[model samples]
Structure formats: C-alpha cells, structure tokens
Target: MQTSSNTRCCIVGGGPAGMMLGLLLARAGVAVTVLEKHGDFLRDFRGDTVHPSTLDILSELGLKKRFDALPQHRVTGIEGLFADGIHALGDFRGLKPFPYMALVPQWDLLTLLADEAERYPNFTLRMRCEATELIRREDTGRVAGVITHTPEGPLHIGADLVIGCDGRHSRLRNAAGLRPRDLGSPMDVLWFRLPRHATDPDGTYGVPGRGTLLVLLNRTDYWQIACVIPKGGAAQLRERPIAEFQARIARRVDFLGDRVNSIASWDDIKLLEVRVDRLPQWHCPGLLLIGDAAHAMSPIGGVGINLAIQDAVAAANLLAPVLLAPGLPDEATLAAVQQRRLLPTKIIQAIQIFLQRRIIARVLAAHDDGKLVALPGAARFLLRFRLIRSIPARVFGVGFRREHIDSP
Candidate 1:
C-alpha cells in the first residue's frame, strides 16, 4: 500500500544543500521534509573541506561552538612543491576570523545540521527514502510532489514546493527534464588512505611534479591521498600490477617512504570520475534545483561543498517568504534563486577550466616529452608574497558571492 504525506516544501536529497535549506526553512517556521536515500551519512572520501565561508555561516546560525566541538583537522594554507622547493601558495590566515579550513568528515557536518533541524517541530527527515519520480499536476503540469520508494512501500509526498538538492547524479533533475550542460574536465582521481606516522607531514600539501599531481591530506592517524590521473586513465593504470601503481606514487611523493605498501591491491583504491556541468535553467513551475543539481564543480579547490551550502542559503533566503505567504511560488521566484547563484557557479567553473587546460593539461603532456616545467615566474612571484597569497586564499577558502544566513 502507498502512503501519502504533505508539506510546504519537500527537499529531495539530504546532502549539504538539502540539510542546510531544511534547517533554514524550518527555522522560518515552514513545514519542511527532507528525504535521504541513505540511512546514515557515513560515506567515505566525500568532500570534507569546510571553508571559511561555511565557517562564517555556522557562526551566523549560532552553531559555531557545536561545530568547533566536532573532530577535525585544520589546514591553515595551501602549499605546493616545485622543482625549486616547497612554496606557500594560499594562506588562509589572511581571511581573518574564520582564518583556516576545517577538514571535518562530511558525515559529522550532515549530522550536526540534521540534529539542529530536527529541533524545529516543523522539520522532518526521512531516511532510506528514495525519490523515484516527480508527481506533476494533471491540469497545470507543474510538479506537485514526489513519489518515493521506502522500505515499507511506495509513498507519495505532496508539497507546495519541490526543491531538488540531490547531487550530481540527481534523479530529480532528470525527472524534471532538466539537463546540465557538460563543460568538461581532463582528469579523474584515485583516492586511498595510508597510515600516518609521527614523522609524516603535519598539514595537507600538494606535490606537482613530472606528469603527476598528488595531494596528501593530513588526517591525524591516516593520510587520505588523492592521485590525479588523466581522464579515463584509471583502467589503463590498473592494467599494470598494483605494485607499479604504488611505485609511481612513491616516486612522486617520496615522503610516503615504505608506507605505500598499505595499498596491497587495487581494491584499496577508489576511482572518482570527475565532471563539471550546470543546468541551463534551474527551475520549472513548482520545482527548483539547487546545489549539484544546478551545477557540478570540478574538484580543483575543494569548493564543491562550499558552493552547495551557499546555494542552500541563497535558496532559503529567496524562497522562504514566498513559500510561507502565497499560493505556490511562481516560476519567476524560482528563477530568482538561480539568478543569484548562477554567476558564482559560472566564475568558479571558469577558473577550474582555466587551470585544467593551462596548467594541468600542459603538465600532463610532459608524460610524452618527459619534461615538466616549473610554475611560471610571475605566478610564482604572486604566490610567494604574503599579501598576494590571499588572492588564491580568498578564491578557494572564502569563494565568490559567499551567502549569509538570511532566512531568519
């Protein structure tokens, strides 16, 4: 038997965007229901970098102290190794107040948001509920609700507004007939964990050498490492023995020493196929798409999570009033949310594309020539200076058009 429920707003996907929007709307006294397919937020290797903009939002919500209490590692700045030496690239200290990036497990962050949102009587979270299709009004063809698959049976959720905060592979986006235009990316990442010792590096840093780009994230007891390989390269790379892969990593970042042995087999490594894309339009009638549903960012600056959270804030700020007061929000109201967030999404994706084509593609080309040039002199000079370093810091750590908690 199918069950039926109704709410003012039904948010599909309990990701950063969905959870944040749910919390803000609930705070505004809107009846909000968030559907999460997973029973818990325990996924590994998700985006964990909580940037300064997110920190500022947490403080605005009065959740700063609670967030500070979560277990996390602080990355004060970004550094890169060159043929010359390791150079400080981006310094977060310049971004006063929320000066550092906090590397908290995404699960912890989601739990915190969910717990707080649950405190509001108007909010409800349904776990292990998967939205299968959009329920549209027969007369107007406007989206009216979602048909979800739950453990018990199918359930129908009727809502005045349906906001899709689902991720890159969002079913809601597809169900709404909204397609994201693929911008393109040249690399995929292989992620794995290696034991961290007292002798290991204290902070996260990047080693860009030869044709390889390796990043080591300091995770206290273990180092979460990312190995960036050319797009569709993982299959070819894995054709060789796992030992060869380990050797390649050791050759790139020698500090790992013998610890690369932790990768006993290919099973230990996870491949992340990266893509960059965004929808031409983010809404239609009663449905609105935000977060990765609206735009998927490349993993260059670890800004995906930051962008997703910002989208939620902007959506809540723009839609909460209309959602509470009127008949259903018009298409124009939903369009306003996209208009507010589209620029930042486009700008960040543009920067990522520039780096991918100009820097990464050129460096990877050295795989054929067997020669890799160091960073450009002018670029190095800008990153070397303390004052100029903040430029990259602000770009990555704080981001553009950072949103504030404007709902309540």
Candidate 2:
C-alpha cells in the first residue's frame, strides 16, 4: 500500500456527479481530489442527454458559452411515433435561455468539467485510479479514506469526507454496506448506431411497435438506436442470426429503409440491463453517495445523467460551507444532502416504474398489428391537455427542484 495523502474531500468515480461536486468544492476553496478509473473519457454509447436543468447549471457557472460550442444535437421537442402518426411529448418552444435539451457526447461533457476544475488550485484529478475499498476510522467507525489501485500499485487516500459518485455498480457503496433496493424493471435495451442521412427523421424520436419500443436519438452524423426488449431477452436474441435483428428492426421502423443493417454483428450491439433502484441510506458519518451510486435510473426519460448532476449540485451546496471552514462533514450535513435530494429521486423513479409496468411491458407483449396500440388513459389525458404537456417537459428537463450555486 502506498502512503496516505490527505485532502479535505475525496471523490470516487469521475462521472458527471463526481466531477461536478469536485469542481464546485474546489471553487469554494475546499481541497478536492477526483479519482477516475479510466485514463481518458472516450467511452461511446453512454448517456449523452444534457437536460435544460443542467444547461441552467452551466449558465449559472458561466460555462454555457463553452458548453454550447461543443458538437451537440438540440431537441426542441421529443416526439413519439405510433403506427399511424406522431405524438408530441416535450415541447420546449417558449422556455427561456435554452428552449431545448442538448445531446452532446458524455465524454465531452466530462472533459469540459475536468478542464474547468483544473483551473482551481485546490482541485486534483487522478486518472486511471480505481477506488477499491472504503477506509473506516477505527475509533468512530466512520469512513475516513479510500484505498485505490493505480498503475504503480495500491494507494491510500485519506480525507475528512469521502463521496461515492462511482456510478450504479459503485464499490464504495457496497463497502459502506449501502444496499440499493431494486425497484424491478421489465425491459432492457440494445443500443447500436447507424449513419444519419439528410432524408432521415430529425430530432429525438421514439416509435412504439407491437411487442417492442424503438427509440432513435439523432447524432449529427449517425443515429443512436435503442431497442427495448423484455428483461433477460438479450441472451435469446443473440441465439438467433445477426441478420434477423436487422430485418425485424427495419420492418418495424418503416422510415429507416434498411439502414438498420448497419449493425454488422453481435459485437456492434451493446446491451444495457435496465435497473431502477435507490439506496435507503445514502451516507454513513464521513461517507456519502451521490448520483447513480445512490439511485440507478431507467432510461425512459434519458434523465439519469441530469439527475446525477443535480445531486452533485445539491451536495456541493450543502457540504461546501462545512468543508471551507476546515471541518469534517457531520451527520447532519450528510443527512441534509439526502433529505433534500431523496424526494426528487423517489418521484422520478416512481414515474419510471409506473411507465415500465403500465406501458413498456404491455407494449413488449403486444402482438404485431398495423394499428398502433392505444396509450393508457392517464397518458392520453396528460398528452391531451395543452397545459399538462409541459409538465413532462418540466419534469424531464428541469426536475422537481432545481438546486442553486450556493457554494462560493
């Protein structure tokens, strides 16, 4: 084990939540170190949707201009296609500042955050370091540090407080004995990319076919395709020939015109095992969990990354004051972060579960027909009202509560 290095706060996992928290804390004059397992941010097919809430965050930090400069796709409205026609869900026409959700590659978002964090002298980023275990203070039995593995060897990092932002399968969450209560999901997603042409449909679109849901996100040059299938169905799909998927998916999406065959082999398809769950307890004394580390979200709204970034903002707002004064985060400080964020997290998850059980599963089980299956009564009512349509846009775009830049 390497010698211990101390900081005011140590953040595990350099995802949006971790990096955002680290940057905010560092800007508040609190020493912060962020450990990323990967050497660089280059992963593909990850969640890339930057909701209006996050865009607002960038605006608050005065980074909106820079963020807007990056290559991104803007969605003014999220539309759904049935067998007959399209239904509009989220319409961002009259919203202020940014009326659209920006879809930029997640790697670029992380890199942007890191670059800004590096501007602060108190910020430290250690890439290619994976946090393996949470170190507990023997006297108080509170987490005091993290043991990480780097290319050189085992490294011990001690801090007054440790935040776990390591994503859904976080090791720190497990080490702290925080168990996420699985909220059961009915489907998984198979993701692949196909080239985009001028004739292709514009904006983010979803098409619900009998027995399946196909969502297409428009990238500048390609389309990110997600095929929602029944839980544990990916194995069976792989058992069939690769060409079968191309034909089946293309037939469902009449607009794709055989471009679905871009999936050359099984290697091109990435299976995302959908999960909906949250940790009952997000913190223990000196340790706290944020983002997907505490709650894993379904992809229905593409709001997971946005929610995680919101969590980071809340944590920074609550915890920065204590850290800046050179004090360890007390139980109350940790609890406040959870108490403030838990409601939004729960509300979003409940909505996701409701949609999963009522709509998605039923759609997956429906037999093929020329007519589009009717949406549930509540869905129709919500979509019918002129005023209610924006509710979902607000929920998915801005969330229940918007945290402010209270730190520094």
Candidate 3:
C-alpha cells in the first residue's frame, strides 16, 4: 500500500546540506522533512574536515559547545614535504578562537545536527527512504513533492518546495533535467587506515612523493590516509601485489614503518573516483539543488563539506522568510540562492582545477618519468614569510565567501 504525507519543505538526501538546511528551516518554524536513503551516516572517507567558517556558524547556532565536546583531531596548519625539506604550506593559528580545522568523523557531525533538528516538532527525518521521482503539479508542471521507496512501502510526500542535497550523483538533478558541466580531475584517491601512537606526528599533513601525493589525517588512534594516483589507476594498481603498494607508501611516509602492512588485501582500501563538476542552473520552478548536487568538488583541500554547509546556511537565510509567508518560492526566488553561492563555488573550483592541472598533474607526470618534483614556486614564495602562510590558510580554512546564520 502507498502512504502520503505533506511538509512545508521536503529535502531529499540527509547529507550535510540536507541536514543543515532542514535544521535551519525547522528552527524558523517551517515544517521540513529530510529523506535519507541510508539508515545512518557511517560512511568512511567522507569529508571530515570542518573548516573555521563552519565552526563560526556552529557558534552562532549555539552548537559550538556541543561540537567541541565531540572527539576530534585539530589541524593547526598544512605542512608538506618538498625537494628542499618539510615546509609550512598554510597556517591556521591566526584565525583566533577556532584557529584549527576540526577532524571529527562526518557521521558524528551529522548525528549532532540531526539530534538538534529533532527537537522541533515540525522537523521530520526519514531514514532508509530513497527518493525515486518527482511529483509534479499537473496544471503548472511544477514540482510539488517526491515519490520515495521506504522499508514499509512506496510513500508520497507533498511539499511547497523540494531540495536536492543528494550529493554528486543526485537522482533529483537527473529527474529535474538539471545537468552539471564536468571539469576534469587529474587523480583519484585510495583510502585506508593505519595505526597511530603517542609518539606519532601531532598534526595532519601531506607528502608529495615520487609520483603521487599522500595525505594523512590524524584521527586520534588511527591515521586515515589518502593515496592519490592518476585518474583510472586503481585497477592497474590492484593488479600488482599489495606489498608493492605498501612499500611505496612506507617509503613516502616513513613514520608509518611496518604499520602499512595492515592494509592486508585489496578489500582494505577504497577507491574514490575524483570528479569536479557544477550545474549552470541550480533550480527550476519548485525545486532547488545545493552542495555536491550542484557542484562535485575535488578533494584537494577537503573543503567539500564546509562548502555544502555554507550553501545550507545561505539557503536558510534567504529561504526561511519566503517559505513561512508565501505560497511558494518562484524561479527568481530560487535563482537568488544560486546567485549568492555561485561566486564562491566558482572560485574554489577554479583553484582546485588549477592545482590539479598545474601542480598535481606535473607531480604525477614527473613521477611517471622517474624524475624528482620540486615544490611549486608559489609554495616556495609562501614559505619565505611566516605571516604570508595565512593567505592559503584563509582560502582553504574559511573559503571565498563566509556565510553567517541570518535565519531565525
């Protein structure tokens, strides 16, 4: 049997964007429902770096204390190994108050947001409910709701608005006929975990090795590591013996020592196909898209989650009032949200594209030729002055535009 329900706003995908938007809208007394295909947010290798801008928003929403209470690792600066030696790439010490990026697991952060949103009677979070298609108003052909497959049966939700927060592979984007332009990435990442001890490095950092770059996130007891390789390289890599991979990693990050062997088989590592793309148009008459649904970012600086949260904040600021008073937001009203967020998205993607093509591509090419790669000139210049490191820090740690919590 099919069931039906209605909400003021229905957000598909209980990701960072969906949860934050649902929470913010609910706080403003709008009835919002968030649908999640998964029963829980426990996926590994998801973006976990909560940047300073997001921290400031948490403080505004009075959730800063709760965030700080979560078990997390703090990254004060970005360091990288170069031809000369280890150099400081960016420093976050000057950002004051929340001077560091919090490396809390993404699942924990989502749970915190969900718990807070549940306090409002108007907010509903439906887990294991996969949005399958859009429900349209026959007269105007405007999106009015979504058809979802729940554990119980097929369910229909009628709403004044529908939001797509379903990440890069968004079904809603496809259903709405909205397409993203693909800006290519040079690499994919192989993710795995290794043990960390009291004597290990205190902060997260990266190593630009012979051909590939390695990023290590200090996750308290274990190191969540990303090994970047050329695009479409995972199959060839797995064909080789696992020990060969282990030896390459241990050689790059020597401190890992024998712990690299813990990656016993191919099953221990996960391949993330890196993609960069963005939608030229982010909305239609009754629907809007945000976060990875609108733009799939390269995991260069780990700014994906932070950028999505910023989108949520901006959406709430502009959307709450209209949702509360009006019949429904028109195309122009929805376009306004895209206009506000477009510049920042463009700026970040531009930087990521540049780095991928200029820096990352060069490094991998040099490695393929068995040649040594030197640090880029920009990095060398930034290393010359202590205060200058904060520029990139601000760019990555905060972002192009910082969104504040303006919605009640």
Best by lDDT: 3
Model 2, 1-408: lDDT tens digits are: 456688889999999999999999999999999999999989978889998899999999989999989999999888887654677766776566678889899999999999999999999999999999988888989899999999988889999999999989989988988899999999999999888889877878887878778888999899898999999999999999998888777777777755867788999999999999999999999999999999999998899999999999999998988988856779999999999999999999999999999989988888755344545567766776656667777788888888778888
Each candidate's root-mean-square deviation in Å?
Answer: 1.6, 1.9, 1.6
Instruction: Give the worst 10-residue stretch by lDDT in candidate 3.
Output: 365-374
Which regions in candidate 1 have their CA more than 4 angstroms from the true location?
Answer: 368-378
Q: What tens-digit string does per-residue lDDT give for candidate 3 at 1-408? A: 659999999999998999999999999999999999999999998999999999998999999999999999888888875556677878899996688889999999999999999999999999999999999999999999999999999999999999999999999999999989999998999999999988987777778866888888889999999988999999999999999888888777777876888989999999999999999999998999999999999998899999999999999999999999968888888999999999999999999999999888877766443222467788698677858988888898889778999998
lDDT of each: 0.89, 0.89, 0.91
Best of the two (2, 3) by lDDT: 3
For model 1, residues 1-408, the per-residue Cα lDDT tens digits are 659999999999999999999999999989999999999999989999999999999999999999999999998888876667677888899787888999999999999999999999999999999998999999999999999999999999999999998899999999989899999999899999999989876878877866678788888889888888889999998899998888887776677758889899999999999999999999998899998888988889999999999999999999889988969889998999999999999999999999999978766656632222366788887876888878877998888888888786
Model 2 bad stretches (over 4 Å): 368-386
TM-score, one value per model = 0.97, 0.96, 0.96
Runs with alpha carbons beyond 4 Å of true place in candidate 3? 368-381
